[model samples]
Target: MSEKNRDGKRTARERLAVEREKQKSAEKRRRTLIVGAGVVCVLGLAAVIGVLAANAGKDKKGSEEAGPVVAPSGAQGKDSLAIPVGKDGAKSTLTVWEDFRCPACQAFEAAYRPTLHELADAGKLRVEYHLVRLIDGNLGGSGSLRAANAAACAQDAGKFREYHDVLYANQPEESDDAFGSDDRLIELAGKVQGLDTPAFRKCVKDGTHNSWVNKSHQAFEAGHFGGTPTVLFGGKNIYQDQSMTPAKLKEMVEAANRG
Candidate 1:
């Protein structure tokens, strides 16, 4: 009876050990899964933040107040460039020359895009966007030439609107962070859909076709532009005088149509 008792005790001990080992293995697996999940969540959040920052850094700034708060136009010009806004009353084609890094350019976009949209929708204004990069400096800096080139690269991949809208929307706070570095620009480039990222990088880094941007910059500065959103109608320069409200812009456009 004593020997039988001893054997029973040994068997019970072995079973207990097995159970404990099984529990230990399960705990290890749970910890591993938890760690993996945390990593994924962090990565996703980082991506979201990057996108939002890029968008905000690209829009709105101040400009000159001279002729009309907004540029004016006549009946839609013949075979000129247009982004097409509104189809009401008279139609006029207007050209916009913009520098990506300019604060005034940013301000102009915010003030004008809605009216332009309304007019295009109403067959009133056909606005042609001529994106002019005026940023200059190294990859890690911001300038007119740099901005123009980067934007041009973005355009090649058929992401002109996305890139344009994003940059204009994100116009950086007027400060050291605005003319963002090459890495910053590349990061900004990543947010747009269908933009070929690697190719865009190669183009901006190598300064390929940089001359194209230089010429535009020279032309703008020489043209006596003191601010962005320089408006031209049928080859005539539209002047700016005060801070433009939507109402003011419409007034100018209507008056130009009459003249």
Candidate 2:
């Protein structure tokens, strides 16, 4: 072959080999980048899963506590705390199943507090409060159970009614789970006369009445009551009657007594 032709052919082959090497290097870089991106995506997904699992575990633990519930001395009936407002010969008994976190219960307390107290104070009816954890079950928080336990603790300190009133008075919005904090409960106890003592604080912090709260919730379920603020006058569902009013409640008690 001619020298010039041979030289040109060798140069052409060398150039092709160089282009091939460049293409291979570029492919290798792209593959490395794709593999790195996949690793990062998998790690990010794992982190999210870990966080969700931890939160789920925390929620489960919040619902289920250890040990049996110990009812306070003030507890009466089958998992209820009796707050007697009237004389020994009251004509009717009003059993109330309430949750601290229930908005309806808060409204009921606001509308009927005065009338109920007047009737109870006059020895016309006995008010029995059964605390439940319905809100906890519905809202997925410990607020209802914790507040119920705190109320039981208040009963131990002989300030249940006062503390109960204060709790409703300062109740947070139904969606805001403020009562989950033990400190907030203790802070509220300070408003009630003689309820902020060391023993009371200890009872709240140690969740002394958690078992009783659970038992009360069980009682509520067993009773087959529909929801919180279940107002029963002599075992009759007063809430179901559309015509039922706070005034009508008093009249009913008087009429029942006469008959």
Best by TM-score: 2
lDDT tens digits, residues 1-259, model 1? Answer: 6999999999999999999999999999665542343333233233423443454444322111012211112212332212223343555777777766655566567656778767666665667654444332111134444555566666555565567767778766433445445666677777886664678788666554345554444455566643355677657655353444567667767676667
Shift in Å, residue 87, candidate 2: 4.4
Candidate 2 error regions (>4 Å): 1-57, 79-88
TM-score of each: 0.52, 0.74
Listing every candidate in turn, what is its Cα RMSD in Å to the true structure after a full C-alpha superposition?
18.4, 20.5
* Runs of candidate 1 exceeding 4 Å displacement: 1-91, 118-124, 130-141, 177-180, 234-239, 247-259
lDDT of each: 0.54, 0.75
Q: How many collisions between residues are there in candidate 2?
A: 2
- lDDT per residue for candidate 2 within 1-259, as digits (tens), equals 9999999999999999999999999999765542343333233233433444444556532546776668876577744444344456776888888888877678678768898888887777788888877766655578888898899888888888889999999998766789888999999998998899999999988888887787777777677676667788877877656577788888987787787
Candidate 2 matches the true fold with a TM-score of 0.74
